[model samples]
Target: MSRLLRILFLTLLLTFTACSKDDDSEDGGTPIAGNRLSTGDSARDFLSDENFDELVIEVVYVEGYRPTDAALNNLVQFIEERCHKSAGVELNVRSFPSPNIAEFNIQQVDSIEKVMRSQYNLGDKMALYVSFLDGKFEDDSDDSVVLGAAYRNTSFVIFEETLHRFSDGINEPDRFLLESTVFRHEFAHLLGLVNLGTEMQTDHLDTENGSHCNVESCLMNYRVESGINIPGMTSEENIPELDSQCLADLRANGGK
Candidate 1:
């Protein structure tokens, strides 16, 4: 129940917030590949090319901290397989040189976003940041700890020292799988899964959580009580893919 609650709180915090900076003047000029962000915008309107043939993803990690080869491979394979197999869209995943990792309070997400935009000169590509912090995230405004978050065209997955320790009973393989799952989950938000991007064709939208789907088995499900089980990691078979309704929304938005 504790893990579930933590997941729910982080999920909701992202769903209700926007990543826009205070000064648009310093915005890296070009917008992210997807659509423009606006107040109250339910879906991102992507600026996909006419053919939708390519999409770029920038992966960045804190200096001196890196995921194992297996973990990194797992993430790359998952994104490529899912995007190609489901939507027929090709992905160009670029890894950036590690930047200085910041121990950020939850309230500093906006500031972090700005720093990232400036460091990478982010424009027309999705950015994924992985941070290795020894402490849990706290909000000066509130007591809820944030584990991970995604907004606009950027997403971050932080691995806290306390959460990933071997004593926690999550081994390396398991931890990597959990990390991969969280990556996909947050990236799905950028893709506008469920009711976040496009209106659903079916009644599968979880209205209570407006940003996620009602289907419990889907990757876009509002809450993940425990981490998702993926093939080659948790299960012998069964690769994780977006549920039908969510796929339909991606298809409609030039994803394929």
Candidate 2:
């Protein structure tokens, strides 16, 4: 069927292309992920620790092009609960408005630099992009883009699609879990991790040593498409404790 073909197409594209997303509300949003962006070979400059107090997150919800409300709420709660229960990091999230998402592209790093020039000097503290990146996979991998260059040193932006390829369409709980899972997946990236890459490489998954992320009950696994669900409900149990550096950042600065 065409739908089956579409899913296959999307899977292939996503394996190669990074994606992004945004919610449509003022008080909430979700984080999404795409391909690794090469901000040239240069390392990013992070704000000094003294500047942590000035780091203000300004979320630009790119609505029209993605699933706006329901999906994002699930993402927000998942991150909040997971971070609090697992790492004790309390993230402060706020949402703003934005133009069409289709117009944004991963290569357009300069637009992100604009956020730094604004009144809040937000570019120095936060990255801006749509909220839809809360992990919903899309049939069209190119439909969205995220901008993180300005805050690349301290943070990154993920733009995800609205529709989940496997949400079972209208089943509410399944949909919620779909978004939540992706939200966790993408946010994990903010902490800096890498994937195994491609279907062929999946055999590298270490199921017995508890070393590979592909474990069914681990927060870091991405094999849900095969019905491998991580065991716990709350993130604290599902995910292991944060590494020292991440925990230090979470404890000291609060996952900002």
Candidate 3:
């Protein structure tokens, strides 16, 4: 071929290679959206239409602790259905054995620290801390101590034994939210879809829990997101489902 023809062929090849699908291996392999942004995004920024892929997930359960199999099943189902995940990676739901509850909690804290320190090496991007006990007590009285916690690094909790989740039919068990609902909210946090109001302050963040957001029937609307004006279990009506815009926000955030 002539020199001009050869040059033209090479140009086309380079263009095609540049447009190949993004594995989203950047941002520590967190699987970011097609675009990354520093400013907050609106509900329409990321949603359906754009290619969405599910990042690999890893969930660690402190062994010897019995929360509920229902919670586990619901959580898995939630991630599978809601997120734009087209299925790229596997979520490892792990359970480590520990006989001492006190010792285990301390270890859990330590493990979280380690994960943060070595985030560069770990895959799956996010990890969760799910518990049914208070730092002091194992019963309802102290359950109010803290409902949930997240470190903005995919860290948080769900008190399965809290008065809200208690079997006492009278209590109505708001805290014992459907497993899928809880997972949807937390995963959104890592994806940067929701804000963590204050460290260790469950009430600081926006939640549908026991309020109007739930009535909206969106995943972002959990009963816990309930505000003063919002009613309890408001998500019952709306469900806070994430639309296309939410998916875009996730892509730009590197999907913690």
Candidate 4:
């Protein structure tokens, strides 16, 4: 190649490499595409401080469907206990007018996230988005109802309207207990529980249910996130916790 052409090519290559590094560093070495990845894809980022030294939970809810303070507190406590964010964890809560939808599918929930979510991985902080909606999940049936779902690496939705319907009724669980249980259960999915991003230390995945623990008493159990099971699962004063097998998996995957 000519000398002039070769020099130009080298300069262009250097510029491109510098820009790429800047982009990667801005996102804590995660690509922009990583933000849209599937659930549990960022489990290590959430559990360990290798990439992110701080965590921010951005919670948005419909005006009339805000989660109880107790539930939100429980969620913060749950994360602090497991994840190793040395710079500390923070919660930012806000509310929006109801979207006026009675039922929501995963796609609709994702669309709402795209419009309403304001936080993303930046610098040394990893951000998570949680939404409380005034609707039931589209897949809910007469026999079973979903209380919450972790649908993306950093996004989840809680059917707060549905939770209220099921809780504090005849033979039902307390609203705070039920809300806290669903919140922790969905967050656990983001942390890669029950064979979901973090590898399991032992075989505990429920074969019939998708990405849930087989242990009935564990917070990752399938029934823990179901409205139909809340009465029975919340019969005790305390909420369910991660079983030994699930705890082992978390510890093995950079959790405390």
Candidate with best TM-score: 4
Query: Which ranges in model 4 have alpha carbons more than 4 Å from their true place?
Result: 1-32, 225-237
Give candidate 3's error at residue 191 in angstroms. 1.9
Error of 2 at 163 (Å): 2.4
User: In order, what lDDT does every prediction score?
Assistant: 0.47, 0.32, 0.35, 0.76
lDDT of 3 at 93: 54
| Ten-residue stretch with the least lDDT total in model 1 | 38-47
**In candidate 2, where is summed lDDT lowest over 10 consecutive residues?**
6-15
All candidates in order of TM-score, best leading:
4, 1, 3, 2
Instruction: For residue 181, give model 1's deviation from the true position in Å.
Output: 0.4
Predicted candidate 3 versus true structure: per-residue lDDT over 172-217, tens digit per residue: 3233343334445654553444442112212222353321122233
Model 4 lDDT at residue 32: 46
lDDT of 2 by residue, 156-235 (tens): 34443433443444322244454444444444443332221112122434454222254444444333322312223223
RMSD of 3: 18.2
Residue 61, model 3: Cα distance from true site in angstroms:
2.5
Q: How good is model 3 by TM-score?
A: 0.45
- Which should have the higher TM-score, number 3 or number 4? 4
**Which candidate number maximizes lDDT?**
4
